[model samples]
Target: MVFLGGGMPWYAQFGCGGGGCDRIRYMKVVLQRVSQASVDVVNELGDLDPTFDLQQIGPGFLLLVGVTDEDGDDEIAWLAHKILRLRVFEDEQGKMNRSIQDIGGEILSVSQFTLFADVRKGNRPSFVGAGKPEHADIMWIKFNEALRSGGVAVREGRFGAHMRVGLVNDGPVTIVIDTADRH
Candidate 1:
């Protein structure tokens, strides 16, 4: 058996055989049903950057997304479809039975790698589980494109940029999803 990185055997963790590791990829998303949402690009010190801002959505979802190093199209596709079709909005009956598509709502998608923070070790969170900036940018762009192509209007946060996200979570409905459990 071969070991990679730390002391653990590589095959056990990443499913490596002889050639390479088929490490499972995952994406984490926190979805909130929102009456309104917006995003603003900012500097590390939290001052807004004048170059970009997504105004606000009248009604839709605020999505905070995190991608793992191994995440790819498979995770992106599944998540995009799930978000668009998730039945958390209201119908005429006032029950949660309608989807974003059913009501023609918008989406505010934000790249939020902080979702992968591992706080088990101490007070300070570790971000080692999060995907690198370059790969995360690709996944973020693809996610927005997927939503658009699937007929949902998507407003996005600047990929790989520091951002401030603001939202009024409708019904205070929040859901956390990880692609690792889907299979």
Candidate 2:
């Protein structure tokens, strides 16, 4: 079993006996119902690089996503299905009865490995639960594609890049989903 830099065994954790990652723990997503959302790349000097504007969306979801070593297509498929059809938007009677698909909403997805930050020990957070970069990047890209396959417009922040993300929460509605909770 080959361990990565942080003393986390990537090879042992993921049962990639053949080639690709077929199993996973949980593909997590922090979904915020938003009236607006945007993500811009941060330059080396810790400033927003106007030229590298990744994405912005109006009236949709601001998704902060994290992946685990075991996360794979199942997690991606489950999350995409749940999020796209989630009925958080209001209907004619001012009740939350509409799905994002119903309102033709958009999605601004950002790769957020920090979502898995482990703060159990001390002041410093550990990312041992986070997916290795190679796997996470692949799964994240597939997840976005799955979301797009739902027929809603989707935007994304650059993977593995330092980004400044901003959003205006609509209804202040927020949800955190972890596939581990599946029964």
- On lDDT, the candidate that comes out on top is 2
Off by over 4 Å in 1: 1-25, 44-46
lDDT of 1 by residue, 34-152 (tens): 99999888887678888885557879989899988888898888988888888998888899999999999999888888898767556998787789998888888998899898798
| Best candidate, TM-score | 2
At residue 158, candidate 1 shows an lDDT of: 85
Cα lDDT, model 1, residue 131: 94
Q: Score every model by TM-score.
A: 0.83, 0.84
**What lDDT does each candidate get?**
0.85, 0.89
Error of 1 at 27 (Å): 0.3
71-177 per-residue lDDT for model 2 (tens digits): 88988899999999899999999999999999999999999999987675689997877999999999999999999999999999988999989999998999999
Candidate 2: give the clashing pairs: 23-70, 24-70, 24-71
